[model samples]
Target: MRIAILAHEQFPDGAKTALGVLRYADDEVVAVLDRDRSGHRVTDFVSDVQDAPIVAGMGDLEDDVDALLIGIAPIGGGFEESWREDVRTALERGCDVVSGLHYFLSEDEEFVELAAENGCELRDVRRPPDDLSVSEGVAADVDAEVILTVGTDCSVGKMTATMKLARDARAAGYDAEVIPTGQTGIMIEGWGIPVDRVVSDFTAGAVEEMILECGDDHDYLFVEGQGSIVHPAYSGVTCGILHGAMPDRLVLCHDAGRQAIGGYESFSLPSIPTYVDLYERLAEPVRDAPVVAGALNTAGLAEPAAREAVDEFAASLDAPATDVIRFGTDEVLETLLSSNPNR
Candidate 1:
């Protein structure tokens, strides 16, 4: 689909949803609507966000775009009333609208009528099905090698690492699927449980079901992880997802140059060896998955510094490590593809 990322009022701030669409969406992204970034190239700021021109609104949109993706994930996941006009304009232009926010446009009478009249569709990604059940731990028994992207902290690039690995693996002829474990992934991929939305008791179960379902068809399942196992506030869901996925290989995601756990000043992020060992210890009874690689988020770092960080991280692990976005996930992907699971 030819697409325009619609994050007009809120880009370059908390525009992760927009960045994700730009980074991983398979469609042709013709433009991005971010009033704050008008007259700039998206690639100038986010190297991974592609080369699309950043426009102020639909009036500046290039021709032939078929979809307008709501691309900002605000805190509390609420959709803003301010963005409605942009949505209306996209609908009038025959563009299907997809949003990752908790607000459902399909339920809005105006949006629904506009879409119906224009033969467009609205995809509210967080809309869960009524028949959902608790996870049953069935993913553990699946035939594929289950791997997950666990992070040192939230927003440290877990989903980015998972998606990059999946894209690269598919390119290398593997039937790899990154299990979208959050709302953003759900919005992008059309499947996944917002593990955070489900009741706490069912979070792991929901995660398990995603793994189990994907396990049957794919050669590898790279589960997108949530909050840190060490994060003070969001740890519960983090641990729940860990147990449910039962991965045999773990991609430890961490950002370069971060001193403390984000927003938790009292807590200092642990050393690489310490975090990796603790992750293994936590998963030992359930399964003996090793932290096979490190996916270091180097977005804030310069090229030389990022490369140096990758080398130092690789030196600390038995497996390969690299900045998946900047240098690619080749080292880690080769390690997984070449290693014999039973050996």
Candidate 2:
């Protein structure tokens, strides 16, 4: 399908969902709706992904789009009021409106009416399943080797690392699958329970259900991680995923040179060694998961600095490390394969 991403002011960095769709999705991205960077091309900011025009709004779109994807996943997953008009315009143009936010566009009366009138579809990707229950602690019993991506903080490349590793593993002739836990992953994979959207009591259960479904079929399950364990606001979801996954190996993800939580700047992040210790200790009771590797986000850093950061991060974690996007996933994937006894 051809599409346009509505990211408003949060393009590139803040619109992670947009980047993920641009880099990995099968659909063609015709344009990006970001008022702040109106006339700039996506190639100007990010060279690796699909190139598309950056329009100011839906009306500015020069090409016909099959869908309008809400690409910014904010802290609360709230919908922006300023975006309502653009969404309305898309619906009026008979285009599907896809959103990953906690706020459901399908439930909104105005959007709902507009969709019906234009015969358009409104997809809320973050909607949780109705049968979700508490975790049964059976995630560890699966036959597959589970390697989950845990993060030092939010948006540190957990989803990116998980997807990259899964892709490379499959390309290497291994039966691997990515068990997505977020909206962006769900959008890319076409199926997954958004763990963060699930009720707090059922978050672990939600993750467990997916693992149980895919575990026996694939040799490896690359479970995408969520919020940082140290994040005050999002730690619950992070812990739920960790305990629910009960993974055999963990890949700690972090943004290079990030000293504090992304949004909460007052609370500084713990040292890399401290984070490793915390994750291992926390996973001990559920399952003895060790930090097998590291995925560092080195965006905006020069080549030399990025390499230096990767070396330092690897030294601190005492494991293989690399920027999966800039470099390949070879180092981390090799480490995972070597560490897995079944392989």
Candidate 3:
């Protein structure tokens, strides 16, 4: 697939969709469609995208592009009316549209007619599957080491840490697979059921099914977690992720500077140790999943301060810790190796 990402006005937030696609999808990302950023490189905004021209309109898209990826995750994950013209143009050009939003472009008659008229496809990535049911909690039956990324709060690098550790484990000669649980992860990995989009009653089962499919023979199943278990509104999805993965080892993901949960004001964050205990208690029914390491997100802090924060965080937990994004996952992988360095 030759993809042209429709990022529009939302550079980083919209380009976030492109981030996963550029990393995991087997596609030639020809350009990113953000009008104001035209002529700039995608690397200018997302340093990891290698390089793709930021184009202003469909006229600027390369002639051979096969698809237009709606490459932004907005606040509510809803379809923005403002993106209509861009998507319409893409479809009119006979490029299939792939959307990860909660809104289904396939269900919209305009998009449906456009795709049909142009022989283009409309893919809705967040649509729940038809057969999902309550979780049987059968993931523990697998022989693999199920390791999950649990976070102190949402958007605290849970998915990134999970993917990072999986990459490290593979490089170290272990067979590890990261099981994605969210829309972005699904987009990256190509087959996960979006547990959050499923009916609340079936969310856990959706996750459990994903685990059983991927957890069979891998040395480690790095389950990408969703919302915080302590988050008031999003706790249900978090609980589903926790119970479905049924992990035997856990990695706690948090940011260096998040003193409290981002949106909620009433609660101050407990100490890292306390938060670790909280996760342990929830996972106790499945296994005594120790918080094997702390994965810190020290993205904006100075390099020296980030390193200091990593050292201090490890000291606080008396366990392995690293800014997995800024730094590498060697320390965290070493901690896992100490217990079982599988080949």
Candidate 4:
């Protein structure tokens, strides 16, 4: 599909969902709607992803788009009032409106009417399935080795690391699959139950369901993780995933030099060692998942600095580590394979 991402003021950095789509989605991105960076090209900011024009609004798009994707998954995942005009414009132009936000665009009367009138779809990727229940501890019984990406904090490259590791594992001749747990992952894989959107009681069940479905087919299941276990607002979701997936191993994800939780500056993050202890301890009762490796996000650092950060991070965790984007996932994948000798 020909797509235009609506990212508003958050372009390259704050728009994690947008960057994921740009890097991994099979759909063609025609334009990026970011008023703050209008007239700039995506290559000007990030050169690796598919290059596209950054336009001020939908009216600036010179080419027709099949869909307009909501690209910013903010702290609360709320839809901004300022973006309503662009959503309306996209629907009026007969383009499908896709959103990954907690705010359901399909539930909005105005958007619903506009989409129906224009014969367009309002696809809410975060919507949970109707028949979800509490997890039954079934994920632990899966035949595959499940490696979950747990994070020091939210948006610290858990999803990205999970995707990269799964890809590299496949390249190395292992049957691997990415079990997406968020909207961006769902969009890329075309299947997953967004645990964050499910009722708190059913969050673990949602994750368990996916693990059971794919476990028999793949030798390795790289479950895309959500939220940090230390994050005050999102910790519940994090715990739910940990208990539900019952993973055999865990890969700790963290942004290099992040001393405090993103957006919650008043609360400082625990040390790397503390985070490792916390995740392992939390998963110990339900499962024996250890933090086997580290996936550090060194995007803010230069190549030399990124490498240094990765080394330092690895030393702290006492495990193999790498900037999966800059360096390949060889070290991490090798560690994963080595950890599961019997598999």
User: Each candidate: what lDDT?
Assistant: 0.82, 0.92, 0.82, 0.92
> lDDT tens digits, residues 1-343, model 3?
7888888887765465677677556678888888888988877866654578889978777567888888887877888888888889889999998888888999999999999999999988888789898889788777678888889888888878887788778888999987888777776776677878889988778878877886777768889888888887798999878877778778888888898887786777789888888888988886567788889988768989999999998888778899886788887888775654422
lDDT, candidate 2, 1-343, per-residue tens: 9999999999987899999999888899999999999999999999778999999999998678899999997777888899999999999999999999999999999999999999999999899989999999999888899999999998899999998899889999999999999999988787898998888999899999999998999889999999989998999999999999989999999999899997789999999999999999999999899999999999969999999999999999999999999988887899897756533
C-alpha root-mean-square deviation, each candidate: 2.2, 1.6, 2.2, 1.7
- Ranked by lDDT, the better of candidates 1 and 2 is 2
What TM-score goes with each of the models? 0.91, 0.95, 0.93, 0.95
List the candidate 1 regions with Cα displacement exceeding 4 Å.
9-13, 340-343
Candidate 4 lDDT by residue in tens digits, 1-343: 8999999899998888899999888899999999999999999999678999999999988799999999997667888999999999999999999889889999999999999999999999899889999999889888889999999998899999998899888889998999999999988777888898889999899999999998988788999999999898999999999999999999999999898998899999999999999999999999989998999999999988899999999999999999888898997898897747534
In terms of lDDT, the best-performing candidate is 2
Clashing pairs in 2: none
CA deviation > 4 Å runs, candidate 4: 339-343
lDDT of 4 at 280: 91
Instruction: Report how far residue 338 has shifted in candidate 4, in Å.
Output: 3.8
Could you tell which candidate, 1 or 4, scores higher by lDDT? 4
User: Least lDDT summed over 10 consecutive residues: which range in candidate 1?
Assistant: 334-343
Off by over 4 Å in 2: none
